[model samples]
Target chain A: MANISQPSQGAWTRMLPNSAAAFHRISALLTLAILVIAFSFASPAFLSVNNTLTILLQTSVIGLLGIGMTMVIITGGIDLSVGSVLALSGTVTGMMVKAGVPVVPAMMLGVCMGAACGLFNGFVVTKMKITPFVATLGMMLIARGAALQLTGAAPISQLGEAFGVLGNGALFRVVEMGDNGFPRVIFPGIPYPAILLVVVAIVASYMLRRRAIGRHIYATGSNEEAARLSGVLVDRTKLIAYTLSGALAGVAGNVLMSRLITAQPSEGVMYELDAIAAAVIGGASLMGGVGGISGTMIGAFIIGVLRNGLNMGGVSSFIQQIVIGFVVIGAVYIDQLRNRR
Target chain B: MSQTLQAAARFDAETTPLVEMRGIEKHFGGVVAVDGVSLDLRPGEVVGVLGHNGAGKSCLMRILSGAMAPSRGEIRIAGDVVEMGSPQDARAHGVETIYQTLALADHLDAPSNLFLGRELKTRFGNLDDKRMLAEARKVLATLNPNFTNLKDPVSSLSGGQRQVIAIARAIYFDVKILIMDEPTAALGPSETAMVADLIRKLRAQGIGIFLVSHDMHDVFDLCDRVVVMNKGKLVGAHDIDEVHKDDILSLIIKGELPTDWRPRNLGELEAAR
Candidate 1:
C-alpha cells in the first residue's frame, strides 16, 4: 500500500534511503566507493595498486566472516563466538599440521572444528532455549579459553610454507625477464586469499538468492511465529545459519594463520566486532531478515579502506577506531530513518 | 436434535466427511480450553464456528489446523486418523489455514510468501524463482485483477491486497479444507464483500471451508451450517435456514436453546425453504 501508486514513476524514490532492500545495498556500495575516492584524494599512495590489493587482502578475513554473519543476522540470530572459534580452529589445524597431517586435510579439519563450534552455538540458541546473544557470548569465552588451554597459552609457529598457500599465495603470477637485470616480476594477478573471498562470496550470494533454505531464513527472521504456522522449519533454518557462520569463521582463521604462519590464541580477539560492523554497514539489520553478501563485501572494503586511509592520513589507531565506530553508527542511523519513512 | 434442521442439511453428512474431529479435548495446564467436542466437515461445505472471546473457537481451529495439538483427540482426514504433530503434517494432509494475523512474512515478496515452506525448485534443487513468479501472477489474478506489484514485500500491500495474498496462499496448493480465521476482521466493507465472494467461489470449487468468525451476518450469508460454542463446549449445529439468528445467539450466550424454542416440523422447514 505504501508504494502502490505508480511504483516505477520515481527514480528518485528508488535512490532514497527508504528504498527497497536492493537499493539499501546500493547505498552501502556507494558509501564504499565514496570512501575509496575520498581516501585516494587524501593520500596519493592510497590509489596505488599495491595499496589497493593490500586493502582487499586485509578485507578477506572479515568479508568471509561477514558472509556468515549476514545469514545468522537474517535469521534474527547472532554468533559472538566466531572470533574465538577462528582461533580455536586455527590452533587445532596448526597442531594437526605440526603432527605431520597433510596441510589440506588439516585445513579442512580446521573448518570442521569451526563448524562444530557453530553447531554448538546453534544448539544452545535453539534447543537450550537460550537467547542467541547470551548463548554465543558464552561460547565466545569457552572457545577462547579452549584455544589457550590447548596450547598452554603459547602460539603455534612454523606452520611451514605449504600450508601458507591458501592465504599467502598468488594466482596468475607474472614474471618479466630482462637483460638489464635478472628476472623481474611485472605483476601478481590476484592474491589467493582474495580469490577465495570472491569464490565464497559468489556461492553465498547464490545460496541466499536461489535456495529454499534462504527463503526460510528470511521468513523466520521476519516473524518466527508466523513462519512456524506457515510450516517453515524455523529451528533447522537457524541451525544451518549458525553452523555456516562457524564454517566461514574457520576459513577466515585458516587465512589468518596462513598469512602469519602462526596460530596465536590471542589472534582474532575483536574480529567478531569487525564482522558485525561490516554486516551492519552492509545494510544488515541487527534485528535480522535484511542483508546480503554483496553489501557485506562492500562493508568489509569500507572498513579496510577506512583504516588504510586513516593510517595514511597519519591518524592514530585509536582515532581510527573512533572514526570507524561513528561510521557504523551513522550507517544504522540512516537505516533507521529509512525504515521510519 | 431437530428433524427440520436435518431435513434442511445442505451437505450429505452420510458420506465420508472430508474432516472428522473425534472427541477433541485440549487442556492448558489446569485450564480447560476445549472440552470433549467432535465435529465433521464434508466436502464443499462451509462450517462456521461461532463463539465469544476465549470461548474456544480459536483453540479448536488451531488444533484442527495443526498449529496446536489437542491434549486428547483424534483427527481423521478422508476417514484416515492422523497424528498432526505440526502444521507441516496438517498441510501434508491438504489442510491449509489463513490465520487471523494473515501470518505473512513482511519482508518477502508475494511469491516468496506464497511458497514459504513448500517452495518450487529446479532440477538442480535450487529455488525456481521464475516459475514461482509466473505461478503467483496467475493465482493472484484469479482472486484480484487489481493486484499488481508481485515484486514488493507483503508489508507494502493494502489490507485487501494482503487478504488476497493470504487467501491465495491457502488455496494455491492442493488444499481440501481451507481454514479462514476472522478473514474479514481487518478489511473495509468492500474488502469484506470481496472476501465473502471469494469464500463462495472456493465453496463452489468443492473446497471444504472452516470459517471462524464473529460477524453473524457474514456467517449467515456464507455458511451452510453454523456451530455455536460456549465455554469450550459445543451447544449445537443448525442448518442456516432451520434456526433463527436469535436461537444461535441463545446457544452462544447461554450454552442452551431458548426455553420457548421448538424445532420446526419437516413440512414447515420445506415450505420456508
Candidate 2:
C-alpha cells in the first residue's frame, strides 16, 4: 500500500482557479475605473463626496433587486415578475397606511405578500412543471393588474412623515469646506436603503460561499438530473431561491415608496430589465451555476455610475438609454468570452 | 463444473446471499423491459451481468439500485425485504449505484461532489468543509494515490479521474452492495486496470459488486460468475471456470441453453419463479 501524503490544506482561494475569476473581476474594475476617470474629466462634480454618495443611494434599490436576481440566475431560473411584485407590494403598503395601519406592520405585510407571490411562482415552476420564463411572465401580468386594481390606477400620496423617513432619512451628517473657504453643505448621511443593500449583499455572499444550501443551488443549476440523483432536493432549492427573490423585491418596493413619499402603481415598470442587466454585468451566467454577490454589487454600481455620469455630462436621457442597452450587450458578450476559456 | 453440477452446488450452499431479487419484472407502458428475472448476489463476490443492447440488463440493475421501481418483485437484503422508493432509500439499505453517466456535478470540486446531498455538518448546521476535504483526500488516496487535484472541478479532470471521484462517493458512504454500470466503457487500458484493482480491493473488504458491462474480456477477467440475459429473460448463470468464451457468446447471441446442459432442480426453481 502506498503511503498517503499529508493532505494539502488551505483556504478555498487555494482550491479555486484564481486567475479566471480574477480576470473577470479585473475587467469589471477596469471598466468602472475608465468610466470614473472619463466622467471626472467631463463633469467636475463627478468625484465630489456628495455625488459619490448620490450614486450609491441611486444603486441601492436596484442593487437589492440584483441580489435576488443573482440567486435566481445561479439556480438556472429567471424571474420576470419582480418589478410587478414590487409595485403590488408597495401599493399594498400604501393602502394599508392610508387605512390607519402602522407603517412597520404594513411594510411587513407587503414583504410577506411579495414572498407569497414568489412562492406561487416557485409552485408553478416546480409542482406544475412550468418553465420559469412563462410562469413568471404570467405572474408579471397578474401582479401588475393587481397593483392597478388596488389603487384605481392612481398614485397614493400623502404618506406620513414617519414612513417617509425610512427612505429619505440619513444615518449621520458630514460637514466639509468648499473652494471659497465657506462651509459647504456636504451631508454624507448613510441612506437607509444603502444600509439594507449592504446587509442583504453580505448575507447573500455568505450563503453562496459557505453554506450547503448554496452548494446545492450551484449543483442543481449545473445539472438537475445529477443533483436529484444525488439526493439534493432540487425542487426545494428552487422554491427557496424564488421565494427569497420575491421578499427582496418587496424590500426594494418599500424603499422606492419611501423615497418618493408616494406609492405609484406603475413605479417599478421595466425595473426587472435593469436588475437582470446588473446581474449579467456582474458576470452571472444565464445558463446558471456561475456568479457571486460581490460581482453583482459592482455591476449595480457600474450602472448607477454610468447613468449619473451621463446625466451630469449633459447627455440626453434617450441617448443614455441606448448607451445602457449597449453596455448590457457588451457585458454579456464579455461573459461569453470568459466562459469559452 | 457443468450446468447440472453448478445447480447442485447452489442447492448445497448454506450461506445466505447478500442480496436476493425474486421474480423481478419491469414494464414501461406497453413494453416489457425486464420479465420475471431472479438474481442472487453473495457477499465478497463480483457478479458480471452480460446482455445485448435491449436485453434489459441496465433496466433490471436500475430497479436494483432504486432508480426505478420494479413492477412485481420483492428485494431482500440479507433476508429482510425492503421497499426501494428512491435512491435515498437504497442508500439507507447500503446499496449504491455508479451510473453510466457518473451522475456528478461537473462544476463542483471532488470533495463537494463527494458529499453532494449528504454533507457533514457542524453543531450549528453549517457545512464542515475542512473535515469533508480531509476525508475526501483520504478516501481518494486509496483509489488513486497520485490524485492531488481534489480542488479542481470534475469537469477539468480526465475521464478516469472523474470515475475515481464517482466510485469514491459510493464507497465513502459504507456501501454493502455496489452496482457499477459500464464502469470501464470509456476508460483506457491503464484506467481499466486501475478499476479492476479497485474492485479486487473492494471484494477483499467483503463488498458485493454487480458489474454491468458489454466487454466479455472484462467479465471473464474480473467476475467469479457470469449471468447472461436475452430479451428481458435470464438465459443462464455459470461459474467462470465452467463456461468457455464461445459458450457465453453463443448463449448471448442465440438466447439458448447449451445442448448438453441440464439443471439439477430446474423444475423446482421454475415453480418458485
Q: Give the best candidate by TM-score.
A: 1
Per-residue C-alpha lDDT of model 2 across residues B4-39, encoded as one tens digit per residue: 223314322687788999989999898999989888
How far is A320's C-alpha from truth in model 1 (Å)? Answer: 1.0
lDDT by residue (B1-273, candidate 1, tens digit) is: 544323325566577898989889999999999998888898888989999999999999999899999999899999999988899999999999999999999989999999889899999999999999999999999888888889988888898888888989999999999999999988889778888998888899888999999899999899988888899988788777667788888988988878887654457766768
**Candidate 1 residue-wise lDDT at A184:** 78
Models 1 onward score TM values of: 0.94, 0.90
Candidate 1: deviation at residue A40, Å? 1.2
Kindly report the docking quality category of candidate 1.
medium
Q: Which portions of model 1 show Cα errors greater than 4 Å?
A: A1-19, A176-184, B1-10, B264-273
Give residue B234's error in model 1 in angstroms: 1.5
Cα lDDT tens digits, model 1, A137-250, are 999999999999999999999889998888778888788988998987687668988999999999999889898898899999998988999899888999999999999999
The digit string of per-residue lDDT tens for model 2 on A259-337 reads 9989889989988889998888888888887777888888898899999999998899899899989988998887766
- Of candidate 1 chain A, the 10-residue stretch with the lowest lDDT total is A9-18
Chain A accuracy of model 1 expressed as TM-score: 0.93
Q: Which residue pairs clash within candidate 2?
A: none
